[model samples]
Target: AYFKEKGKEVIYDAEHFFDGYKSNHAYAMRTLQAAAQGGADCLVLCDTNGGTFPFDIFKVVQEVKKNFGIKIGIHTHNDCGMAAANAIMAVEAGAGQVQGTYTGFGERCGNANLSTIIPNLQIKQHYICIPENQLVNLTKTARKISEIANVTLNERDPYVGNCAFAHKGGMHIDGVCKASSSFEHINPERVGNKRRFLMSEVSGRKTILDKIQEINPSVTKDS
Candidate 1:
């Protein structure tokens, strides 16, 4: 009431929402109701412990949307290694916004990874969140944030990882070399990354062919 003297919009975050909903569904719904009645502009459901699965997150968010007419948001952590997955699923179930960090950096594992989420939503899912040009700088942006935070970037991190598009297996190498989309789900270049073929026992001739060409574009298969 005091803060809203100027008609400022307020958001109410229901922390530990999954746990609270599980413990007492009525109380959790009531909390959201109270916030809406009190003029909250948005209601964010937090996965405080970060243990809820993506399916559960989707279900709970669906329920919240069904019952409340206010804008719905979601906050997730990576304790179960599903923060990104859960966030995506929640959006699928009608969440308006997803709260996350650059490299999923935060307390108790970390938050959802916007690095992974942004591209997935914009490029793959075709959701309009940011400018199209913003997608091109995702990889460099992730690395920069990681550097600023003094955290080693995960090579296997989706979309922006060094190894996200690396192919090693003989079959995979052959397939990707023939057609990149065969073995890769998304174009690495779409997220400012390039495809890589790691030299290994399983590497195929095509792998060497591609690498040789990368090193010296003039080199041909006959040579």
Candidate 2:
């Protein structure tokens, strides 16, 4: 009420919300009700410890959205390596907003990875979080953020990671050679990344044949 009277929009962050909800369901809800009464424009449920499971997040967020008429948001930490999953679950349960770090850096383990969450929502689920053209710069932005933070970009990070679309194994390379979709979830270029074919003994003959054929279209497997 104070903020609202002063012409301010308050986005209330319910810290340790999942933990509180698990420990005391009624009290946790009472706290949110109080925040609503106090004129919070949006209620952001936070998994402070990052210990909550995705299933629990989904269930609780669903309940919160069902009971409240206000806008809902989610903030999850990556302590359990489930932040992205938990955030996605919350969205599936009807939360309209998600909070995360661009490069997944934060206190302790880290925060939910926006790099992972955005693509998951936009490319796979058909949700639009940003301008379609901006989405293509995801990998570039992630790399830039990592550089500014002086942290080496995680090569295995989904969508923007170096190895996220790399293929090295023989069968895998063959499948990718036949059709990129055979081995990749989506085009790496979608996020401003690229396909990488690692040259190694284990890459198999089919991979070599594909490469040779790229230069010499008449090349045959028997030859």
Candidate 3:
């Protein structure tokens, strides 16, 4: 109320909100009501311990959105490896904003990975979280940020990971050869990654031809 009277924006964050809501639902709602009555500009629900499941998050956020007329946001951690999923669920249930760290790196188990969340929300869910032109720079930017932070980016991280689009074995390569969509979720080029066909014990003639065609597009099994 004091800040609102002074015309300063106040974003009240409800930390450990998930646990609090689970422990005492009515009390939690009352606390949020107090913040709203005090003129909070926005209310951010935080999963401070990062242990809540996605379903629980969805339910709580849904109820909050229904009761509060203010902007709702989500802040999650990755201790349970559900940060991105929980964040996405919150958005689905009506969170207007998502709080996360780029490349999913932060304290303890880290925060919700914006790298994963951005693509999932933007490309998959059709939300406009970033400029359309900058969407292609996701992988490169993640790498640069990881390098600067001296944190080795996980090669298996979703969307920006090196192995995210890599295909191996003869059948896998053959499926990808027949149709890029067969073995990939989204195009690697769309996010500045590349499709890799690793040579494996199962590599077949079709796989070899596919590799050769990379160097010489005209070369084929018939040729």
Better of 1 and 3 by TM-score: 3
Candidate number achieving the greatest lDDT relative to the actual structure: 2
RMSD of 2: 2.1
Residue 52, candidate 2: C-alpha displacement in angstroms? 0.4
Sequence-dependent TM-score of model 3: 0.93
1-223 per-residue lDDT for model 3 (tens digits): 9999999999999999888988998998999999999999889999999999999999989999999998999999999999999999999999998999999988899999999999999999999999988989999999999999998999999989989998777888888878988889988999989888787788877778877999999986889
lDDT of every model, 2 decimals: 0.89, 0.93, 0.92
Question: If scored against the real structure, what TM-score would every candidate get?
Answer: 0.92, 0.92, 0.93
Residue-level lDDT tens digits of model 1 in 14-44: 9999999999999989999988888888899
lDDT of 1: 0.89
Better of 1 and 3 by lDDT: 3
lDDT of 2 at 14: 98
Model 2 ranges with Cα > 4 A deviation: 206-223
Supply candidate 2's per-residue lDDT for 78. 93
